[model samples]
Target: MLSAAAAADVRFYGGAPRRRRLRPRSCLASPPASGGGCSESESEKARSLLVERYQDGVSKRYTLDGNSKLQVHWERRESAVNTVEEEEDANSLIPQAVKDFVLPAGFPGSVSDDYLEYMLWQLPTNVTGWICHTLVTSTLLKAVGVGSFTGTSAAASAAAIRWVSKDGIGAFGRLFIGGRFGTLFDDDPKKWRMYADFIGSAGSIFELITPLYPGYFLPLASLGNLAKAIGRGFRDPSFRVIQNHFAKSGNLGEVAAKEEVWEVGAQLLGLSIGVLIMDTSGVKSSYSTLVLTWFSVRLLHLWFRYQSLSVLKFRTVNLKRARILVRSHVGHHVVPDYAACNKEENILTWERFLHPQISFGVPMEIMFDGEESNDMVDRLLKLYRNEKYILFVKPSGSRSAAFFVTFKEGATSMSVLRSLWQAHWLHKNLQRQDEVFTWVEESVLALEHGFTDFLKQMEIAGWDHNQIILKVPKEPVLVIEHPDQEV
Candidate 1:
């Protein structure tokens, strides 16, 4: 019964089952005597049993005791060669330190969906822009007479004075430009970025020509420095605002760190190239060569800048984007989304001359010239009594008009958007025979009828209602008592 039980228990777990099981032999109950013929034969039997089990893919072993025990061991086979190959392929050749310096920690996972595309264009734009900027710096320094070392104290003093005065003018220039355009930068960063780049290139041109006018070096170099400073003022803050748009994961710090790394890398490369160019005989000495190279590079820089801005699909509604949506809806009866409007937007604001210019949050005093016409103001107020904003339109040119929107206190983003749509409707339908008041009246009526449905269509088209990019002026809100309203 014991032998039958042992044979029944001898089961294979991994390999195929055998039809017959071997019964425990008497050799399993006793230890084999050392150096004897019986012992040798028993050892051969044990070896043959293990070989058979291994061949069947189920390995087992036995020990000699009165009550013997059986042991079974199984291990999953590992394909180490394939694993090693996979590891090698996944690894990078860049040193860990360099990777840490160049990339944000937790990278692709840490950034927004638009970050990679932004950087793809930004890399070439920064590289080429820095190269041109470096060349401009080299030429400007040469024009300023500080390009090379000098031995004379008077010459050194003059160079020092020139550099200091030029920088002083630039510092003031930056302050003025930054203050003047700060609001516009936040409202329309994309258009301003293009403008800033072009202005910076103009500064480069100014600096490049300074060598020709040796007698007027101070004024020309200062002007160049001033223009470049204005460009920097606008470009830096505009870039910051644009970067903020890409931090969907709230990882602005990581995004900015990686951006700084790219900027520094591009600047270093530009410096290296500038050194090589300077080392070439007659490159810096010849103004024509420098001008030719700078102009060609400046063109490339502008093109890259355009390409970079083109890839950015901002969901926010700025004036240009709002105009696209309104025009599409009003003219074609089709609502376009943020992406479509962004693609249709002109980075240079060329459409500024084509359509009516819209200005938001104009002061009440300025709009009505200090309440000189109370009756007119009251009539206008009653016209838009249902709305939170007031619109005023006037002919700006022979072909174009200017639409000024002044918001009352407690106005919201929706109010501003509604006013924009109404203003656009007025722009499309206003005729020579239509009085400004009558046309505005018709626009208000249309707004009352269609604005809610317009908003629904906008929502359907993927417009972000919460993010209106229009700038609200800090001027005092309008307040005039109406005879018909309760105090």
Candidate 2:
């Protein structure tokens, strides 16, 4: 008889008894008590049977639960894993260099719709008028110098002269006649030679009659006055030669005509002066020259000066505006939420108020949920630290997909909070610097969601589960640090 203790021990260590073997008929008629020892052969046989039963139980459980089969089925279904592995050969789509370069801190709020409309309407007209005026003035000056004033058919020039003259003859024509005797004849050498001669002669006159005009008898006396008047008149608020002249005449049509003429005259004068200075020095005048010497001189001078002046003015006044506009444009690329808001009308007003707060170069971090392993997390942290930009962490199973950590300059956490408060409380500063983080948060989530969908679609297309990282939405928490700590 097998001892009870030994039988129990065998059952426990080896396996559960088989249903057929556990039957009463197969058991010993009288089982031994707890202390009764069994023969060595019986004990060994019992152990062997228990071991066989245990193996059989394990085989039954695996088949009934379907665990092994499911694993094999999954392996077969995921045949596209190889393809996904091939695709992931490149680490990230964003270039390492681009990732290394810091992104701008915040979004430049959109230009208001109204301001954009206004700029669209106003800038083109203003720029066109300025350009046309320069062209006409240059042409007329050349015509006058070459004794071919009649040849210039610029309607604008004629209108200017008629407007300026008291008796309806243009001021230049009247002045020409008044100073006719002192001036060299039209047939005289190019205006450049005459200018040099005049300068030499005027030097002697000034020495002889120093007290007559006092300090005004220099070569530039007449030309300088003209240039100064033109520059001042165009830019000065109080100087309204065209407007005032038209008002006094009480003729709207005449005013329009004179405005055109003045534009032409100014252009021509600048051109003529420039030609005399630049082209006339080395080139000698000749009879019957195919090129209209004076006209050519005037055109060249006017074109050169006009370009120079326009460029200078653009640099001085509009360049800053242009730069701000460009910054706004480029900023849109970095943070896209504000792109639609940057209309011209809005820009016109918003730029004035908000441009100062905006600065460039902010850091950003993107963390994905599937990368929750300790090693992966460390790698991401290392990547963020190496770049020296703020890290945004999105944990798995989080509602919000993005959150910003600290960056070097620009929006601090408090400042961002403040801007949010102000935007909610005050008039919407669409171009506000504070909104940059907000926009960044939204944009990252959007990108994350997009990446997620892309991965899913890839899976559906027969990709392996392990081949591509699936993005999971994670709770975003801001990690604040002391100022002394390195970001």
Give the whole-model CA lDDT for all candidates, comma-separated: 0.64, 0.31
- RMSD (CA, Å), each prediction: 31.7, 32.9
lDDT of 1 by residue, 1-487 (tens): 1222323222221112223344444443321233222255444443211111221122223222222222111211123754564465459686544444445544668668888788679989977875565456545565567545443345544565666678778767677766454456666788888888988888877788877888898898998999998888888989998999988899999999999999999999999988898777777678788778778878998999999999899988876787788778877777887777888888876533536566665533234432333345546766777776788777545566677776665566677778878878888887853366777788889998888888888889988678876644433243333344212
Instruction: Report the lDDT of model 1 for residue 28.
Output: 39
TM-scores for the candidates:
0.62, 0.18
lDDT of 1 at 18: 26
User: Model 2, 1-487: lDDT tens per residue?
Assistant: 3323222211110111212122121223232334333344543343110001111111000010111110000001112653463355345575433322322111114334475467558879977885676656556655556324556555545544432222222223223322322221111112222233233333333333433554453433444333333333222221232244236457757776777798799999977965665555344343223135544654564455434322211111121232332233234322111122122212113222342222111111122223323233223333333222334333223222223233332233223222222222212223333344454444334433443443343344343433211111111112222222334
Best by lDDT: 1
What is the Cα-based lDDT of residue 186 in candidate 1? 62
Off by over 4 Å in 1: 1-158, 279-285, 350-354, 357-377, 392-404, 431-439, 483-487
